[model samples]
Target: MEGMAITRTDMLSVADTVAREKSIDREHVLEAMEQAIQKAGRSKYGHEHDIRATIDRRTGEISLARYIEVVDEIENEVTQMTLGEALSEKPDAKVGDFIVDELPPIEFGRIAAQTAKQVIVQKVREAERERQYEEFKDRVGEIVNGVVKRVEFGNVTLDLGRAEAVLRRDEIIPREHFKRGDRVRAYIYDVRREQRGPQIFLSRTHPQFMAKLFAQEVPEIYDGVIEIKKVARDPGSRAKIGVISQDSSIDPVGACVGMRGSRVQAVVTELQGEKIDIIPWSPEDATFTVNALAPAEVSKIVMDEESGKMEVVVPDDQLSLAIGRRGQNVRLASILTGWDIDIMTEEEESQKRQAEFNERSERFMEALDVDDVIARLLVTEGFTSVEEVGYVPVDELASIEGFDESVAEELRARARTFLETEAERLDTRRKELGVEDALAGLAGLTPAMLVALGEAEVKSIDDFADLAADELTDKEDGILKSFPIGEQEASDLIMDARVAAGWFSQEELDAMRAEAAAAAEAEAAEAAAEAAAAEGAEEA
Candidate 1:
């Protein structure tokens, strides 16, 4: 008992030095030392024995002991004993009690000391890793300054003082190179706990990296007086940032450009001289898109809001400039404005519009049994299909230039007759295709769509119910591919078929729809709020 506990002031001093060096709590270092001593004690004694160790926080006194369980039946001779054996040692000993035997101070041999050192080093490294991860995880999305520790095959490893971050080759800007001991600035894009360790991924070419750089250089942006709506980067080549100022007196573009271009120049140098277009962000997609494609004039823009698509018509000579080198300008604008843009010259757009007009006129001439002159008049008045002529109000059709009420009624009658005849033909073809009646009863599947589904071998309700929305509406080869119905409507039709096939009860589907609608409402609200703060582009 006299020498069972040993005190060493040097132990406390070692813990203090290691804790300070590793930036870990001193108590954690002491705990690691206790584990090392426990392993040493277990090595000196039998390895199977239950050995425990502790160190007093104030005095650095180490205590080691072996515990044996007092039980009705002995499990092992080393760690367990029957109650009769324990009664001889202590009168108050009972079952489920642990009889601890204090161990004597262990003399550290070379092998034992080496094993203890390995344990201590491993535990300390683990503690250090936890500390680093906790400190850096929330630092993601912020720009960090670091020193280049090494460069391997163009991939850089930056030493961020307390942590290491990897800036992959793909994440580095073109023409940017780093050597060892060089100071570099990067954006912390992601932090993940990998199997090897906590990996912090950095990027120099990320769009937000440019935005963050501007935020650092421009005071208005940092203070939230000027808002950066969107940023698109072609890294080391060019970029466009859309900005909107909350205050009318402050022009966002002018503020970002700064006095004498000082603020913008600072960012430009950091980005390796990537040309930037600080455009004004407009809530109108076409206007903003026009601004995004600067240094080139746009003649016209046509937008299809439902499809989020745009066609931009530029003068034939300005096409190259608007498209930029390798279509980079338009691509960046598309990314900035969130639209898929198709650029065309005025001649091409005019020719395309003429072709559409001719197609509609021919369709009207055939469907209404009218001459080319009358068909052209109807097409000029915005009639595209027989269905439109059939359903439009007779008075509205009569109000068209040079058309009387009797002529309008006769034209609409011919359109309805043609549509009825087409429907009969489609129904007959659907029947000929072996499409089932149960599938015909499903809403949103027209006679034409049913024929297509039948040709694709999805005739029965069960067959239709098993298909996904993409299979029903895929633009490439979906059964209803020719129809204008979107994926959501296709899914609803398929869901209805599922209900008909008894795959799901109506009540369950209703509940699911209610939940989905709620989620969609929330998502739409968030998207609208974001859109209000952003811009969109492209139309011809």
Candidate 2:
């Protein structure tokens, strides 16, 4: 073993070659070798090896020495040596100084090579994992340009610059298709470590994607000249967007639409023919609402601010168009405008107008008082009406503002006088309209089928009878399904039929059924007689 041809120079050069090839530091390789050799030495020797390892950092030279302490006499087998024996190798030896003892030449065998290779491979794997972890951990929420690698079950695999990302099935817009090797941009939503590798999640259906698309296409949006106020999408079918402009000079709608519909068409083509509605945003909810119901003219908008509701009236010709097929237009407009919208045709509006006219007419007939709200406020202010505050005590009326005692007394007298005359007039009108007789027709109605309704005090045919199917559904659960009728049919049954008991006279219904049977019998008998005549003629 001592006569082996291996030299330290050869090992040093070989260490440098291994370190460079594996992209590891030369000193690290040397340290690994020293550890391996120390382990081997301890295995070969029964006791721990008195080994010292040294390396030249630049040259990658590693040298190992077995050492013993020089002593007057050898006391331990591993550490101590007789001074005369130590001085034989070294002429000047001290009692405590280390003495170098070269080990027998033991060339690194196949076992050592295998051990070094295992360590190198393990270190490289850990390094690679660390490198990949550092690389992707900082890439969240970014837009990555990638190529579509493949599509499986509607999910897409994209080849990002340094890794791969998955676009989930639902993240893809409906009816959109991508071919392999197509270039695309995606929003990097998440980056997570997984068993296979780093998993990156990308999305195209996200609302932010639309905002980014607008930012890219419309310079006004990017420059803050126009702002996208709200967006509601039925992904791939249609999208409604509300836009506003900070500068009065810019029309937000036209800016989004571009000249001759270029900008919107670009976005639409990218969405594969998805329709988009670009409506100008208004701070005034009423004005915004009117714009939201675009492509159809609206007659009026009555807003109920407390409920965030707006009842819109459109011409009869435009009602269907405004409501769209299945009410999609108004529904989208509601979503876009953040209001619950109710649409009515011009005819329905006219009926409502007439109803309101009748109510006003009745109020006019009974107008012996101020408005209800004003009356309530007056009572709170220690006055009941204009006449009471106007005529009786001017000081008391003046306390409330704009009314003196004389004015209060005059108002009180006027109210009293108006009450008497108005009551008479109302009575006359009620008789003329026959409203009392009409209500009386609903009296003493007891039908078993309508027992639940009767228990709820549905005395008038016009009471429960004027209710919509949905209202009836709330009062009596599952009635809509049981009835299985359209809104018009239900309306007709409630309004036209009045009550089941009074729907038709039983005797009249029986007579009609009997007449129908008789007519059917007469027609059958005529047919039989004609057949017999034909048979007789043929036999003759």
lDDT of each: 0.90, 0.68
331 Cα displacement, candidate 1 (Å): 1.2
* Candidate 2 lDDT, 1-540, residue by residue in tens: 232423667657866786776555666666666666555555455345587656566654556678888877666868778878788888888788788866653455666556645665555444444455567678765567899999998899998755678999898888778889998787777778776666788887665666667878999887767888888776677777899987899999999999999999988876667788998888998898888888889989888775466899998899888997678889889988888899998789789866765554444234535555444445556543333533555565555665566656655666667756655665555445433334434433223224435444544556655566665444246344333344544554554434434656556656766898899999999999986886577456
Clashes of 1: 7
> Candidate 2 regions off by >4 Å?
1-143, 189-198, 304-308, 349-540
How many clashes in each candidate?
7, 16
Compared with the true structure, what per-residue lDDT tens digits does model 1 show for residues 260-311? 9999999999999999999999999999999998888999999987667799
* TM-score for predicted model 2 compared with the true structure: 0.47
Error of model 1, residue 56, in angstroms: 1.1
Against the hidden reference, what TM-scores do the models get?
0.84, 0.47
Best by TM-score: 1
490 Cα displacement, candidate 2 (Å):
33
Q: Which ten residues in a row are the worst by lDDT in model 1?
A: 531-540
